[model samples]
Target chain A: MNRDGARSSIDVLERYSGETYGRALLGVYLAAPTVWLVSMYAGHAAAGFAAFLVIFAFGLAMDLALRRSSVVLYDERYERISRKASDAVFNVYGGGGFVVFVSLIALEFLGYYEMTPRVETLFLAWSAFVLSWGVCYTAFKSRA
Target chain B: MKNRLPELREREGISQAELAEAVDVTRQTINSIERERYDPSLELAFELATYFDATVEDIFLYEADEDGV
Candidate 1:
């Protein structure tokens, strides 16, 4: 402990603030749409696979950045709090994803929209769902 | 749950950050505890009690229903 009675070293990495994670998530969202569009234009299954790889790389990069920045150490108490916060965000994301997916399928079935069951389209939709969850989680967690 | 973390920290003349460090938590966690936005776990309650040289009951007050139901 220092003069202030605080611990001298942190045992765990700190969680990034909503602002920081939100910005990184935004970058992923933007890049995902562009990749999907390019793949669609190329009209090749290989192009779709490449798009998936690029998006996966972007997600990996964000994870790495978060870990690198959260070098601050914390104890079990802090870890529990962080875990609960993350769990809440993921729960909401899962529910929202399910609802949107069902709604989309229903719209197609009802003839409200023309749906193509193409592999590329499926990949694009999945990517969009993931990015949207990131955006929502960040926005919700960042609220004052 | 209501706690005396803020009052106790003030009496000790330590910042929330300092208290958090002493308790091995983030400053935000301390702030939330003080504000009653979150409750500490049993292990954490004991840690805080040990740090403040007080019993857990002294720092955290629990009240049952007035009717004792």
Candidate 2:
């Protein structure tokens, strides 16, 4: 390809990759909540498991697509900016989530709110996993 | 930190997109830099200076404190 053609292609790739990543991120949030709601209303363990499988498969596919696209599109500057943005977002999410979780626990202990041990454990595990994923992903992407 | 990015880019006959492409950043980042809403990292500043064939000091102007510290 000519110089201009290559440059344009790179631009297109960057845009496509960014959009795909954004959509995938949004999909995780939407799909998970929708599945949870569906499972809650359906009141069936099988239904919940099925929904979990579907969401997991979708997430895996998106992860693969993002990996492929990012490999082609990311440069040093892009990586640096992405790292900084990701870190900032992760810090806010982690810190805010921790405060909220502690407050909820305190309320539960004080009898102002009620939460089962199982539910509390699930919430903590899921949130910790997400926070760890964000941190790890940023570190991986920022690495040379 | 205030910068003369827009002026320099205009003088060089390049759009924000073009400058962003040359500097390996998003156009939004370039726009933010031009608007003085975002400050570039030292490495990015050096990259911009190198691309414009000028020193970083020539491109970015840092204002002194009112107390003159």
Candidate 3:
């Protein structure tokens, strides 16, 4: 053992600290509503566009904070907390997806949301949920 | 998975915090390693070796029986 008795076999994950993954996830998360907000304000021209810009800036700032806070390799307690949090996030989202899927199937069979926007919302929500969870799983699995 | 990490730590008269700092890791990591729930990377193995002035094998000997755990 080294003087401090730490073994060299432990793998510390330090990958993706750069903004690439964070930006990508943020872009995906913000795209739909930001686009809707922009579209909603399009009739107002400059005022609406300015509002969209402000909202987008706020969204980006939040994203930046999240990315900054996501720095996880330096501290052990933080790492454990992060792992548990990520696992909880994955499980919650996965459960939500399963519930949504079952509901959608039930609705289709029962002819409830056959022609309503409910179906479209389900599709959008499921897509976003799956995509976000996919990224989380990748990030978690890649951690050592 | 079972080894004499605690014994070794006691033998060296080192605290987990001191050992963690010296090894450039968190005390929990050393604790986890001792518990055998996790394995160290080659770099960490080398770090532990260099810290103890011993070979990696001296600190982390592997056993086939332990693998089934």
Scored by TM against the true chain B, the candidates give: 0.89, 0.91, 0.82
TM per model?
A: 0.48, 0.52, 0.49
Error of 2 at A104 (Å): 7.1
**All candidates' lDDT scores?**
0.71, 0.75, 0.66
Docking level of model 1 = incorrect
User: Which stretch of 10 consecutive residues in model 3 chain A shows the poorest summed lDDT?
Assistant: A5-14
Give, for candidate 2 chain A, the lowest lDDT window spanning 10 residues. A68-77
Residues B1-69 of candidate 1: C-alpha lDDT, one tens digit per residue: 788988999999999877876776667678888888878889889999999999999999887779985
Better of 1 and 3 by lDDT: 1
Cα lDDT, model 3, residue B51: 81
Winner on DockQ (1 vs 3): 1
| TM-score of candidate 3 versus the correct structure, residues matched by position | 0.49
lDDT of 3 by residue, B17-65 (tens): 6677677666667778898976777787788788878888888878877
lDDT tens per residue, model 3, A58-83: 76665554444433224444456688
Q: Give the lDDT of residue A20 in candidate 1.
A: 40
After superposing the true interface residues, what Cα RMSD does each candidate give? 4.6, 4.0, 8.0
Error of 3 at A23 (Å): 29
- Which candidate do you rate higher for TM-score, 1 or 2? 2
Q: How many clashes does the backbone of model 2 have?
A: 0
